[model samples]
Target: MRANLKTANLKSGDLPGDVTHHPYDAYGLPLMVEPASPALAKDPLAVQSWFAEHHRTLEALLPTYGGVVLRGFAIPDTMAFNAMIQCYDTDPNGYAGGLTPRKNIAGKVFEASRVPADQKIILHQEMGYLPSFPKMVAFYCLKPSETGGCTTIGDMRRFQKQIPANLLDAVHERGVLYRRNYRAPGPVSDPLVALFRREWTDVLQVETVEQAEEACRAVGCEAVWEDDGSLSMRYRSSGFVNHSVTGEEVWFAQVQGMHFNQARLAQNYDTLNKAFPGGRPRPIEILFGDGGDIPEDMVTPLYDILDRLAVNLPYEHGDFMLLDNIYTAHGRQPFTGSRDVQVGLVF
Candidate 1:
C-alpha cells in the first residue's frame, strides 16, 4: 500500500492537492474522484499527475467497487485519455472478433459503439463471451448527448448474490452457448437487417473466410463457413466467472443481449423474426451450453434484476471511467444529439 493512501473507503481530502472522493450513489458504484478547486479541474496535466500517483489505490478498490469515475478534469481528447490509462503502464488491447461497430480513433482508443442513437445497449461485461478478456476497460466521454445517453453499470457480484439459487444452479449446470452468424457481403435492403447484421470481415477484421476461421479458433470458438458466404461461429462458456483479483464468482455473460429478448427488441422482434428464417440468420443466438433453447422465463428475470441494480451514469464532457471488466457490466441508454465516447481495453 502507498504511504498516506488506503485502498478502501476513501473519502474527501484524503489525498494530496485539491482532489476529493465521494460516492456517486448509495451503492458506491463509481467512487467519484474530482478536484475541489477550479484551477485543478481545468488542468488536465495536474489531474494526470494525481492519477499517476494514486492509480495503485484505485486498482485495489476496483474489485470492491467495480469501477471508478474521474470527473471534473477536462481531459481534452482521446489521446489524453490513452495517456491516462498508460500511466498504469498497461499495453493497449485489440478488439478482435468484436460484435459492436466501432472504429479506432486514436492510439489505443476507439469510438465506444456505433449502434443507432435510439437503441439501448444491454448490460454485459466487455468481451465476456471470449476465452480471454481485458481486465480493465476505460471510457472517456468527449461529449454527452443532449438527452438520455447515460452509460449504465451494474455490479456483477451483487447481481450474482441476488440471482435465485435455482436459476444460479441451472446456469452453473447448463453453462451458455453463443452462436453468431455474420452476414454475407452485400447491401441489406431491410432496415431491421441493417441494424442487427455485421459482415464477417467487420467482426473478425479479416478479408478471407480462412483468416476469420483461424481468428475464431484462436479464441476457442468453432467456426464454419456456410455455402451462402455467411460465417457462423459457436462458443461455450460458463454463465458465471470468478473475479480475477478477488476470486469471487460473479455474473459474467452476455446471454441476455445476445438472445435479443422480446422486451429489448420489442415490436421489431416480429419483423426481424419474419425477415430471417428461424432467426438463425440474424447477428447471434444465445442458448444453453448443450445447444438447448433458452426460454424467456429463464432470461427475463435477469433483466429485472439488472434493472433494479443498474446505475445509470450520466456522462459529462471530459469524464473518464475505469471498470473492472470481470466485476462490472456496462451498457448504453438511448439518446439524441451528438454523443462521443471512446473506449480502451487493458489487461
Candidate 2:
C-alpha cells in the first residue's frame, strides 16, 4: 500500500476538523467528515477533483490517526442506488461477472435476511476468496437492527501482530485449500449482452462441485474427501506474485492467502434450516458451509484473532459502506422491524 493514499482537504465551514484541529486518519476509516452541505459534497463528475484535492492530506493524517468519519456526506437516494448497482459491476470478489450472481458465480439466495425478522448474524469477511482485494472499506446502514444489530469493527493489522511468522511461512510454502458446498442460481446473462475487460480471463460459468474441486486444485491444494459426501482440501493461499501497486512480495501466509478459503461450517447452513418453516432458507442457503482455517480446535483461536484484527463494523443508515472486496470480509446478522435497504455494487 502507498504510504499515503488520501489527500486532506480544507473545510468550508468551521467544524471540528478546521484548520486548528485537523482530524487524522490511519487506514481510511475516519475519512468521514461533515460537509458544509450536500451541495458542497463531491459530485460524481467532480468527485475526482475533490479526491485530488484531499487525497494527500487525508493519507498523511490517516497514519498517525486511525481513519475519518463524515456525517453529511451521505449520498442522495438516487445516487446511492446507482452506486450500489455499479458495485455489482465491479465483481470485487473476483467472481468473473459483476451483476450476474449464481449465473456467473456461485451464490445462494436467502429466502429471508434481516428485513423481516430479528436474526443474529455471525461475523465473517465478505468474499474472502480473492487475494489483493480492498484495503479501506465503507458501509452505509439504511436501517439498523431494532435491537442487537450493532456493527462491530475489528482491525486485521492488529490481528497480523498475533500470527506467528513460522505458521505464516508454512501456508506460503503450501497454499491453503478451501471447500464450499455453496451453490446459487445460474448467472444472469444478457441473452444479448456484450462485455469487455482490462485483461482476458476465463468467462465465469455456473459454479458446481466440479469448479469447487478445480478451485482447490488450481491453487495447488491437496484434495481430500469422505465417503459420506464431505470434502476437505488444502492449498497454498498465495501465488508467487507481487503486489501490482506496491511491487511487494505477496506472502502466502498473509491474510490474503487465508481469507475466503473458509471451511464454511455445514452447521451454519443446518441452523438456517430450523429457522425456515420448510427446513430451509433461500438466500441463507446460498452461503452454506463454514470456511475458515479448520481443525475444529484451532478454529476459534484463529478467528478470535481474525475478529479483533479485521474492521467488522455494524451497519447503519446513510452508510454507503464500501470495502476492499478482496481484503475485508463482511456478513450480516439477522434483524427485525420495518427495515428497507438498497444494496449497490460498483467496480
| Best candidate, TM-score | 1
- Tens digit per residue, CA lDDT, model 1, 1-347: 12122344554334556677877878788788887877657877776777788777777777667788988886988777887877443333267677777777877787887888888888888877777777888899999999999999988878888777766787799999888888877787877666677888888888886888888887778997777788888888988776656556777768678875677678788887787767454577788899877777777787888888889988998998988888888998999999998898776
Candidate 1: where are CA atoms >4 Å away?
1-18, 37-39, 88-93, 187-191, 279-281
Task: List runs of model 2 lying over 4 Å from the truth.
Answer: 1-29, 41-69, 81-89, 92-125, 131-138, 164-166, 182-236, 239-294, 307-316, 324-334, 338-347
Q: Report clashes for each candidate as comma-separated counts.
A: 0, 100
Model 2 C-alpha lDDT per residue in residues 1-347, reported as the tens digit of each score: 23322322223222324222333224544345545534436444343344345444433343333443433444544355344333233333343321123222112111112222444334444333333333433444556656545444433334445655554544555544433222223332422111211111222332555774665454344445435233444333442244223343433232332222234333434553433223221212221122224333333355556545544444455544333322233445455554444332323
What TM-score, over all chains together, does every model reach? 0.90, 0.51
Which residue pairs in model 1 clash with each other?
Answer: none
lDDT of 1 at 206: 84
Model 1: which ten-residue window has the lowest total lDDT?
1-10
TM-score for candidate 1: 0.90
